[model samples]
Target: LPKTSNREAQKIVLRIKRKCRETESEEVAVSIGIGVATKTEPEQSIDQVLKEADNEMYQNKLSESRSTKSKIVQSLLNTLTAKSNETKEHAVRMTKLAFDFGEKLGLSNSQQHRLSLLATLHDIGKTTIPEEILKKPGKLTDKEWEIIKDHPERGYKIASSSQEFAVVADDIYAHHERWDGSGYPGKLKGENIPYLARIISIIDAYDVMTHDRPYKNAISKEEALAEIEKCAGSQFDPELAEKFIKMMSA
Candidate 1:
């Protein structure tokens, strides 16, 4: 106990981490944050040593949380990409537009980060949809349309399953909600929809309109912007849609 080196302490921590992971349950993965402090001075009080270790442990916890969120998000994206390359590319494009719009609208850094995640992962539920239905060349039947509309709920459940993704779960669920309360899963109207979800709705509609999909050909940027303007206060939030139109028109 008197001569333990930092290197040896780190080795011990790694061993513990590995063991924790190895013992993880199939349904829930195990993660740990560890902190180690060495007594470099004979005069150091036990209280001081404990305090230092506690501080280190807190910092490690924050770092571990961020790392875990990143890994889970990446895994979801990979799974989504495997299901549909078009959707993945759409997410990439949407993320850039989302950040730019967030900056223009003066959203806080944390809000912007949340918006970005929703932008990319909002359609994660589509991974559960049948491929033929998702890529149908023509209009869907009423039953198929209902099936498609169920994606938001599906996405919400997937996001809610992980602590890291739970932050955006509500937004993912409400992204399709209409300003007029006509949108799916919940007929949440006006300000009842989550703010980030509102932001996503406007941007997502714009992106989808301007891009070619199996069901529809791409429209011009001008048309897309106009459609956004027309849908304001109905399909999209009037204030947010106005801002989006101006941002794209600029």
Candidate 2:
């Protein structure tokens, strides 16, 4: 193949990748490697070219596997968002806010990364709830409330089931735990709760308060912030909530 043909092949591969991103199941990761044997290189056998291309493709696949796993998880989150009242945009906003809070708190790069994932998938377990129960506009009965509260544990199970998400499993499980040991499946208090989970709790609540839900109208941002501040000591880590508020204000 000529140099022009090689360029054309590369262009075609890139086009395929671009198309994958635009596709509805855009989370798919595509890898392509092309090797050309030129007539000018008579000493190079077709087998050698094929072997080189295969090796490059293998390396590409290895590198892309991590990205592929991330995309698949994101796709799952998208499915959850679509099924529930929560929109994909809400997840995106929360991820950004969580990452910002993590950075402001001087968390490590890896911790911030985990926080981003936790923020997106914190409510993923809600998928297990019946659609009618999830979308019910009226107050929940004790049994329905109990079922809804089980989502954290269910989310933990889902996250832990996959190696890619296992890092954030505990965070997802404890996201609903309270600072005063009054909340959720574990009733964890203070530093007993995962720090990332604590951060997520504050941000998640704020997002919920400020966003419209099937059962309620959206509140003002000021009102939402006030509610978060009011719940700081009881529902959220006070110090982290303070820092989060400061970050948002900034």
Please report the candidate that would top lDDT against the real structure. Answer: 1
Residue pairs in collision within model 2: none
> Cα lDDT of model 1 overall?
0.87
Off by over 4 Å in 1: 1-74
Residues 1-250 of candidate 2 have per-residue lDDT tens digits of 4454656766766786677666645434454433333333768887787777677777776666666666666666766776774656678889988877887889998988899988778888876788888778888899999999999999898787667898999999999999999999999999999988999999988898888887778999888888888998999899988887887777
Worst 10 residues of 1 by lDDT: 23-32
Q: Candidate 2: where is the Cα deviation over 4 Å? A: 1-76
lDDT for position 57 in model 1: 87
lDDT, residue 142, model 2? 96
Q: In terms of TM-score, which candidate is strongest?
A: 1
lDDT of all predictions, in order shown? Answer: 0.87, 0.80
